[model samples]
Target: MTDPKSSRLLDNRWDDAKAAGLSESQLLLYRSNLLGSDKRITNYGGGNTSAKVIEKDPLTGQDVEVLWVKGSGGDVGSIKIDGFATLYQDKLEGLKNIYRGLEFEDEMVGYLPFCTFNLNPRAASIDTPLHAYVPYKHVDHMHPDAIIAIAASKNSKELTKQIYGDEIGWLPWKRPGFELGLWLSKFAKENPTAKGVVLESHGLFTWADTAKDCYLLTLEIINKAIAWFETETEGKAIFGGAVTQSADADKRKAVAAALMPVIRGFIGKSESKVGHFDDQPAVLEFVNSADLRALAALGTSCPDHFLRTKIRPLVLDYDPARDNLDEVLATLEASITAYRAGYAEYYERCKHDNSPAIRDPNAVVYLVPGVGMITFARDKATARISGEFYVNAINVMRGASTVSTYVGLPEQEAFDIEYWLLEEAKLQRMPKPKSLAGRIAFVTGGAGGIGKATAERLIGEGAVVVLADIDEAALKTTEADFAKRYGADVVRGVKLNVTDEAQVLASYIETSVQYGGLDILVSNAGIASSAPIEETTLATWDKNISILATGYFLVSREAFRLFRRQKLGGNVVFVASKNGLAASPNAAAYCTAKAAEIHLARCLALEGAEAGIRVNTVNPDAVLRGSKIWSGEWREQRAASSHLQVDELEEHYRKRSMLKLNVFPEDIAEAIYFLASDASSKSTGNIINVDAGNAVSFPR
Candidate 1:
């Protein structure tokens, strides 16, 4: 589900008028979207939906049956028509001739490519057979929390029969593959009246002859489970009833802010990992509960949750009542050390001879009593989604333990799925991460043209950006635009006045909490002024010094603190000006302040060298287009000083350059990108002149 953000009861969002003109295949897509729209129905990338539609064969004009199912690694909630894998139903049925038995079920996946109906490139998921063997024309295989709660209970078969009666049958747990498909098919055939079946320690499956019916039936079954749990567990305690009080909202955030970077530092010694923190009601209740450790240790039941969240979360030793944050900080490395050892032990005990060499032993999810849950992964989305999966697991545990003894999938079975050869192959097949993947950035003056361009460049390479701007309105607009283009998880906006020391401190704290810590800081925020030396007022001089000089120091100081805290090293690129290197006519205040900015970068470079922090400068001149500072009197003043009209500023700068080319915000952004990235790792305290070649303003 795309996070409705508000909890709404499960209501059918299907508009009959909307689905009226759609073809059978289109209707199937429509049905899948509605089911996926609510996380109450299924998770982000969990679950599968299918439809057996009649289509004219691409080879012949004859109508044939084609099974359209959700492709591997695709999310049903956001899936499109092209996201499905289509195969001839007849060809799938013929697979029985080659089926050796349960032992050869893994081989069935290899033959699936030969069954592709139209040469569609989307790979079919392993759940393909489970959907194919079902008699119904439309099928939904969902891992809804409400339904999985029942499925994961110790007496799941009994509970399934009790809650759903004869309409829903129960089946023994079998690893998902060709064999599980046969089990579902045989059960459906015997219980002809059954509309669905509950797979123990797995999830729910509902089917129908038509698309809408199947969609509604899936919702009906899940809602019934939800409603039953509510009634049965009405006055009962959950997770042994929250043993500790939840820290108030603000306190929880402060605690999270303090802990995330420290934990990130310890865990991120190898490859970098981004972090996500959640202290929502559900998470707080789980972490503060009496059974938090025991239930967490048991792990998750559903295969999708297990795979996304790992075998179990690392529950820290924290006392909410004592408020032992410093203690937690001091012992963080030890806690992580213990967790790694535990993960290694689990891997050794559960691993098969052919199992992939013990994957990263670090735990993905971390549970703190008062602070809430912190999850880390290769990028922001994975970290956030890992938290979501654990939330799903928490909901399952809450409901199951209240109504029945909650049971987790066995250790052996969880290991087999986690280290499955096909799963490892899928991991190996993932595309190489972008250049800036797993890096976090803080961009100042982020609402300005150069700031926006630099942010876009960095984000394109996969860095998560925190956009800080003095203008709140422009900040909102740029943040919204970036969020729409790059996804809401990758970019955030903060209103910051670099001159305000308190605001800068608060903004850095916000950044640390929002994203564990920043690896890059593009200090680009500024204003421009033009005046004769005698006419330049104390106010003008102070304004220039406060923003251009003082602002850089404040932001850089905070960045240094966070960099040292994370122990991840750092990169700082100051967006100074050509005026800083060479004197400009009449703009003494601006030129002097810009010079201070350059010298500051050099000083910081010397201090940070031992810690591996790199500080560099990018000097840009006469960037007329899309420059906020240039849009003001600065443009008219510079043009007047150059003996040209305001409109001729671009041409004047272009012709004045040694290369006779126009300097632009994008050109400056390119220089900043290089310095911010590892491309300039070896060259610190250096300067890049992006002024289309100005011999006079060149750095000596």
Candidate 2:
């Protein structure tokens, strides 16, 4: 449905007022963020930017030139000033004396630290030399989709000449290092009148005296490629014009929902993996196309895309016309086995003597015809970012294949980059994964204080969370706050009245669509009512059971269903109450419902035992600080029942407990965290009383 001839794609967001007072390094940061703001300009963490600024040396107190460039593994869009690496310009120029030619170019990375300015420890990246040796005041190296579309074409050199005549130059594909840095310098020197050069199968490099001028030139050149492609491919068929019809939105999601957990289980056999689903227009257009298999086989040409998405994707054996979902599921295991074997074969064939052991053989990208793409990674953000990179590759394929035969990076070269010693060292340097790192959880009363606290704990241990609550306003606020504190990828929110069974199922489906599926379910949604046995009506009793007892059943049933489908087992934690065990006077309805919740969890624990599904309960007492149950009449009723003022409830509860301490939301959250993690994997079907050592509430 895209209009090919509609040309305006990127906007220059530079503001003169914004740039007027910034220092040179600050200006460079501003420019880098501006160019990185759009995917059309660069994929996340793909490009490097730099500026040459004169600063007083900390030791000599004399003005000296320094190269300020993005540090290793930094993303331009979200980068702060601290994310840049500063190196002495003179020291960088002096590294040439020790250069040992192309064979030892990799040795150049080790020497980068020797050139550090002011002892800045932000480690220089491999791209640092590419920016440092440019011989211009400001430089930009971006991998825009349109420009890469041209760079990735079969006749890229000829296309470059036709597109810009002598204004831009082109270079053959070379692994980025000191040798390539010299190549760029020679090209810039040889073509004194040229503004920039495109590295074959790589990206574009542009430079200017001022940061704004470099920013403008980069945008202008990419804009030209965008316009040219719009005209050249205007009437041409894209990806051979979509051989398979795309399933409607609902059907596509349903298929994705069904396949994700199965794929996740296989991929996480060794280490757990999180999933991301993308059915964007571009993704659908490519996946449903006639040329998908052939093109995907060739793999991604750019190094960034190649590294993030692996050599190639596994194409699921699915045809929407037949709607044979069952058949697809049946063959999924065999397909994954074959993909892993092929990946191992690739590593064996292409690895050097010292190459790292073959990494996880499973493919990172999964392509399903008539459905969409699914990506699995060690965590949610990486999975989502990996998918974004593939989309960039898809765009490149669409543009290049329409105009010229699209070409992928050669397999051997890709292997060399994948297993490069420098990259391996970086991988080894990564911190250990958190306890719950690839797990996903759903909190039913996610907007309430305890629900929010539980979510914070889970996310701290690296679990992505989906929050479902009936309070629309509170849900939105909590979602925004969590998204800000954590990341947008780490949390999501949806409205749900847990008592509604259909609504419960729909919410679970939405969670699958949002984050593949669940591994943990926190059943914390409830209500408390206190009425004398004589005055308690049938309505009050039903309401307490509906929200506290039956609602738990609805959510747990759906969780078990998903757990069976994933075959990855599951974790379920119920927030029961101290009242569930000891008879509390004048609160028969509330106490009975809480008791039912405890027994229900025990029943589920027994039923799910064979499948590795663990169910447990946390019993909290008088959590008055942030309990929604205590926000209504329940607070006054409890205080009156205890013969204390509303303000004196905390003290009363503390004095009444054997430990002489009051319980809080955070206390319950810690217990839930323990149950949700593997630390207590062998201790389910039990209760953790977070009630300040109340003997009556203790499990006998």
Looking at model 2, report the run of 10 residues with the lowest lDDT sum.
Answer: 1-10
TM-score of each: 0.98, 0.98
lDDT of 1 by residue, 245-321 (tens): 88887788788888888888888877788999988889988999989998999999999999989889988877879
Residue 271 error, candidate 1, Å: 1.7
Residue 700: error of model 2 in Å? Answer: 2.2
lDDT of residue 85 for candidate 1:
97
* Local error of candidate 1 at residue 646 (angstroms): 0.3
TM-score, cand. 2 vs. native: 0.98
Note the Cα lDDT for every prediction shown: 0.90, 0.92
